[model samples]
Target chain A: MLKTSLSKLTIFILTGFLMVFFIGMSIVFGYTNTSIQLAYEAFTQFNESNEHLIIRTVRLPRALIAAACGASLAITGVLMQTLTKNPLASPGILGINAGAGFAVVLSITIFHISSLQAFAWISFLGAGLAAICVYVISSAGTGGLTPMKITLAGSAISAMFSSLTQGILVTNEAGFEQVLFWLAGSVQGRKLELLAAVSPYLFIGWTAALMIAPRMNVLAMGDDVAVGLGLKLGRIKIFTGIIVILLAGSSVAAAGPIGFIGIIIPHIAKKIIGLDHRWLIPYSALLGASLLLAADIAARYIIMPREVPVGVMTALIGTPFFIYIARKGLSQS
Target chain B: MSKYYSFRILADKISFLIDKKAMIKIGFLALLTLLIFIISAGLGGMPINPLHVLQVFFGGGEDMERLVVMQFRLPRIMVSIFAGMALAVAGGILQGMVRNPLASPDIIGITAGAGAAVVAFLFLFSDHNHSLTVSIKWMPAAAFIGAAIVGFSVYFLSWRNGVTPVRLVLVGIGIAALMQACTTLLMVTGPIYRAAEANIWITGSVSGSSWEKVQILAPWTIILLIIAFLSTRTINVQELGDEVAIGLGSSVERQRFFLLLISTCLVGGAVAFAGGIGFVGLMAPHMARRLVGSSFDALLPTSAFIGAVLVMLADLIGRTAFGPLEVPAGVFTAAIGAPYFIYLLVKTK
Candidate 1:
């Protein structure tokens, strides 16, 4: 058992290192006419030239947004899985993304609210409302807040919100381009002020998640056992719900509804580090950040001057990983 | 022995009594389905009285009125019925095969696949400046191919020793995300007209659905519905668990594969005809199961009926609810079905 654990740890470390290496490589490669020498110089030392503007103003902010969004989503997934005791539970699954998307849609179209700060607040409110709605709906039946119930409720609500978003876009054809861009999710061309607005919430959410990691592990043994050990199930539920809202909401604010990273990364982390949240949370966060950053970099270079959405790149890379983890999980279970 | 013939009659009578409860449930579902259909037809922008609608249906209306009824309302109503039936039947088979309440065409990435393919086609062909008429001909084929790719990928990814429901669901979720990302990417980079067209499709409206769509969709729908009906026996045994199914001499793998194929076809066809219409698949099966128990024979038909009625009602509401400003049936279904679904989820626990 000790030997197996050591091997797993080694694998985890290796994967982490590999991800970082790939991200570095991605940042160096782009569709621009600039030579590799210029790319390196622009990235390493700031200059007032066009190369510096492209690197700092465009690529760097994009990379940061990717990392932040991926990390936030992955952490939210970890919290959700632990809280609901369901592997399928993720921010996207629970309608948090849809809620945020809906709020953004409403703000952009109906109200014409354009400020990033306002967008962030609206997204947060939407996430919170969606979570509460799911909780209330799932809890209404005899099973209380069973994992399956929550999953179903979330799926239903997400589907509904998604359709509503689509409805608004369809009716108001003028906003189609803007809404589509946001919906696809990207970190490109965003101002530093937008990142600053969302950073505090992301930090707070990350802190809260880490603080509750131990409790989550205890809760994993089943609710009755945790309660027997004197843990407050109600308080824990509320706390985790708040963490989900914070992480998912802020991520949406930063980068609109990037998908699959949350669902896939946590599962990958779990396979490497066992079921302990202490290791799982950090590993997943780092892994998610690295994956998103790498994917965003690929998006920039893959099509050259015209970039693909970061969300698409992540999905293309992450789906295969998700399948592997899922197969393994199923076999083990 | 001749005197003992009465005992056989008595035994038959006892068995019939046991079956009566199930028969009654089936009858109630059928009645409710009819009620929903009538109520749905009575609603819409024209606000035709239920009596007038019936009269028009029975060929009692004037020429202009008849034209309006046939051209405007009839196609929408028919599309709703077809789409709803397709979704519900697909969902029922999936839920039974997967033994998970949440397993539906949308959940398994088929709709996403269709959505992605249509969006791509819309963008790729738009630069040609082709007539709107020409584009519609090619869109369904693109959507169908996309759905097939996604369906196969999910199946392949989930396959190991056997296809466990959980693994299938996870892989479906993964592929669905990829498909959604692809749709989003296409929308962002594509031309303005293409993007708008894709958005409308994603919202899942039956608007502008000419007789051509109906013609293309009808045959596939009927064929798949028949196939789903034929597989009911196998599905029933499969749901009992794989070990038991194998012990009972059922080809568990083959049965599941065929069922999944049929479901994907139905879903792909429906999505190609309409867009990513929501809720009918998820809602119909749950409601059907409640009324008809877990028997596949009863559950399949009941689900199809309920699905048809739900979509029809949603479409009617979509057409009439805001007067001239029509809502897509897909939107109303989600807005209405989602909260109720949530309530059901909560209450079931």
Candidate 2:
């Protein structure tokens, strides 16, 4: 047992080390003329030179957005799985991303609203509305919010919102570019101001999620047992719903609908640390951030001078791993 | 006088049998569908007068009116019907196979595969000037190949000693995520123009569909429909679970493989023609099951008809509701079908 625990600890440390190494690599690599050594110097000295501007202003912000977006999405996934007690539950599953995308599309096309701050607020509102809608729809019948029911309701809502967004785009030629970019789920051209704007909400969401980890543990045991243990099931559900909206909304606002990170990362973390949410949440956050940052780094260099959306890279890497975990989980269950 | 009394008695018996609860409900739904279809066909922009449409159908209209009705509107209508029917059949087969109402073509990675393949084509070939011949011949082939890859991957990955529905679904989701990721990568890195074109296609559209597309799709759709029909017996037996199916002398593995292959073909063919239209494959089977009973034999036909009707109505709305600037048929179907699907989900259990 001691040897096994020690080996697990070793793996954890290695993952942590890999995360830091990748972040450094992301800072060093770029599409421009600057060599790796020069890039390092520019990064460390806060150089105001042209090369420094390209590295610090352009590449760094993009990488940071990727990391932050990825980590938040993965954490949201962990919360969703725990709260809904369904392995398939993710932020995308609940239509939050679609709602946010629709709101952004409306702002751009119909309302002619262009400010990033306004877009963020609109996305948050849309996400909140979508979650409430899912909750109400799923809880309507007698068996009150079974995992399967919520999954179905979420898919239906997602379909509806995404269709509406697509309808608007197809009908109006002006909104096409905006919709296309948003739909691709990129982390390019983001500003630190945008990141700062979304940070408070992310912090509050993360804190709330951590605080509820113990309750989630009990909740996972089954609703009746959790209720018997004096947990208010309704309150917990509402709280988690809000947290999902905040996390998912802010992430979407910052960097479009980067998906699969939220769906795949938590499953990976769970395999490493078992079902305990305390470890799962933190581990998923770190791992998700690391994974996204690495993918973003690859995105920049893969097609030099052109970038792939970080979302796509994550999907490629995360999907195979996700498939493996799901298969394993199914067999054991 | 006694003979007249016997005739009245016979009439009463016939009425009583027709007015039984199940029959009345089915009749009502059928009537409602007809009403929707008629209204939809008449409501589109550049409206062909209902009378003119009828006259054209009967070979009595002016050439100009007949051309408009037959060449443009008729093909659009036919494509929508074919797409809807194919998707619904695929959904019914999948849901029955999985024993999960949520199982749809998209959920199983077929849609994602098609989407990814289209994006790859746009990226790799957008720069070439050989437009007409290349697009007509190669586009559908690309979609088919992509869909086959994803479907086969999901099936193989999910198969251990034997395939299970739950494992299949889970693996499909994983493969879908991967395919989506590849799609995004292509969109982001490829030329902006190509990405834009691919994006529009991915959301789905039946706007520019021609007779050629219809011809390409019809044979596969008919063949797959027959396959779905034949598999219904095995599907019903499998619903009793694998142990019982085996005991009853059914080759569960072979049956499942064939059914999945047929479903993949249906989805791939429809998507090749119409892009990744959402919701019909997911919602049609559930609605059909509710209308008829769960027997796959009955459910498949009902779902196909309902699916076709839904797509036709959606196409009509897509063309007419906004006027001139048409929404894709895909968007319309999702808007209409998703809410109803949600209602079903909430009400069923």
Candidate 3:
């Protein structure tokens, strides 16, 4: 771990540079190849060419969305793991993604709402509701929410939401076709307006995550220690919960509930930067952005002309790491 | 001795001891399963009389009644009942083997593996005409292969000194997510019509049940169930924990593997026939434990009955409740099972 401030700063700066490079890679590489020169011209020169239009309209928003979603999801993972005190906690694992996906499908099916603005809010509502349900269920039992209880509760709730989504889709075949890709999760072919819709919420999530980093460091010492340190445990928890919903919800809204980035990035960030949230949070953001951009880039090439969802790519990468951690045992910090 | 009844045959070479109360409870549950079977068979689009359904079962009903009861509804109902029983038994075996209340085939990735296999089967076998190039008979084998591959991998991967329950579950979860990703990738890349078909299968439904599927799944499930029941003594000892089982001269690791194999086979059969019917494996065994206590001999059968009832009821509700649109049985199971699971989580000490 990078202990000295100078080394940490240097690594952080390097990661940020890496993020920029990945974003550029994401933009330049796809089924339709656009050179860096063309990408540059698309940004700088006023050309109404097809490649320019594709670069400007299609690839730019997708890269931006992937980066934003990845960073937001990773931060959400860090907050959730800390909040639940569970190494396995993440929006995807906790039924938040299924919830958001269900809500999106429900809105499309029942209300027939196809507008971009409606999609983002519905996703937030669903994610918040799921997070609340998992919390309430896990906390209600005798032991007051151990990591195991929360994990089980989250998975159970995910099963419920996903089955409900299936029920709706089974009944409405048209809706099945409509949201199938979305449910698998992708940053492909997404409109900039969708990102525009959720960007403010994502921005707030990032800022608040950074602001709350110091308090989280104390909270990591255990609830009793934080309480003895004069922290308002209830208020901080509620604040943390809201930030998680904001970050996770908007990311899901932007990228359709991409999985594993949140779980993978925070752990990787901690390994490189150590456990101090002050450095850890920003470092995770950069690393997460780079990871998703890289995954998105890979998603394009894995099947060639037809793209596999980046969600699948992340799972392919994340499962091995997940298994390693699991085999390493959960007791380690 | 008064609480148990002992039976002997062949000069005590073969003997059985059964708890009288557990027997009574099992009998009552068996009756309840029958009642549910009749009700589910009687309440579809073209409703049949319960008496006529019973009569049709014994070959004494009008041709229309026989067609509706035997041809249309019987296979579907049988599929659900047996699928439920297999899943419940599998869940019971897993919970006992792991000594964790939350352990079940679905939670561990057996079902997900089966789901991925089924989708892959469809994706690979379909020719340009979109019809399966291979016989549909082979699909169940594919699902079984998938579940077995995952189940054994989870077991082998968790093996360091021996397979600890924690590592098994953790590895299972990891593999389950991977299987889910693979399933989704296959579904998304396939044609929309095929995607819908695969979706229904993944969610788990008996909507496409036929006699041939019943023939395959029924025998497979029953054999596994019997094997599971006979191994109850080992599980009961195994549940006492590794040290005690070892102390009792039980080969703990080997028996654990045997039991895991049984549950894996049971799950393989269940998912092969019913698709990925979600929460029955978790819910049924739990409810059975509540009904019959934790003794494996009584617990396994009770779980089977309860599971049969739950899925039969879920299937009934899925097809009948929505009117015109047939929903998959897996959805109703989750709708009920998830809340009950929350209640279990809350109510457990």
Native-referenced DockQ of model 1: 0.58
Instruction: Put down candidate 2 lDDT per residue, B313-339, tens digits, no spaces.
Output: 877777787767777788777777777
lDDT by residue (B236-336, candidate 1, tens digit) is 88888888999999888888888889988888888887777887898899988887688777788888888888887787777777788877778877878
Q: Candidate 1's error at B129, in angstroms?
A: 2.9
Question: DockQ rank, highest first?
Answer: 3, 1, 2
Q: Higher lDDT: candidate 1 or 2?
A: 1
Residue B142, model 2, lDDT: 91
Using Cα atoms, each model's DockQ against the true complex is 0.58, 0.50, 0.61
Model 1 reaches what TM-score against the true structure? 0.85
Over 4 Å off, model 2:
A1-21, A33-47, A93-95, A132-160, A220-225, A267-276, B1-46, B128-135
Best by DockQ: 3
User: What TM-scores does chain A show, candidate by candidate in order?
Assistant: 0.89, 0.89, 0.98
Candidate 3: CAPRI quality band = medium
Better of 1 and 3 by lDDT: 3
Candidate 1 regions with alpha-carbon error over 4 angstroms: A1-56, A84-88, A132-154, A214-230, A267-280, B1-60, B130-135, B247-249
> Would you estimate the TM-scores of all the predictions?
0.85, 0.87, 0.95
Candidate 3 lDDT tens digits, A197-313: 998898899999999999999999999999999999999999999999888889888888788898898899999999999998888889989999999999999889899999999
For candidate 2 chain B, the 10 contiguous residues with the lowest summed lDDT are B1-10
Clashing pairs in 3: none
Docking quality of model 2: it rates as medium
**Candidate lDDT (C-alpha), each:** 0.78, 0.77, 0.88
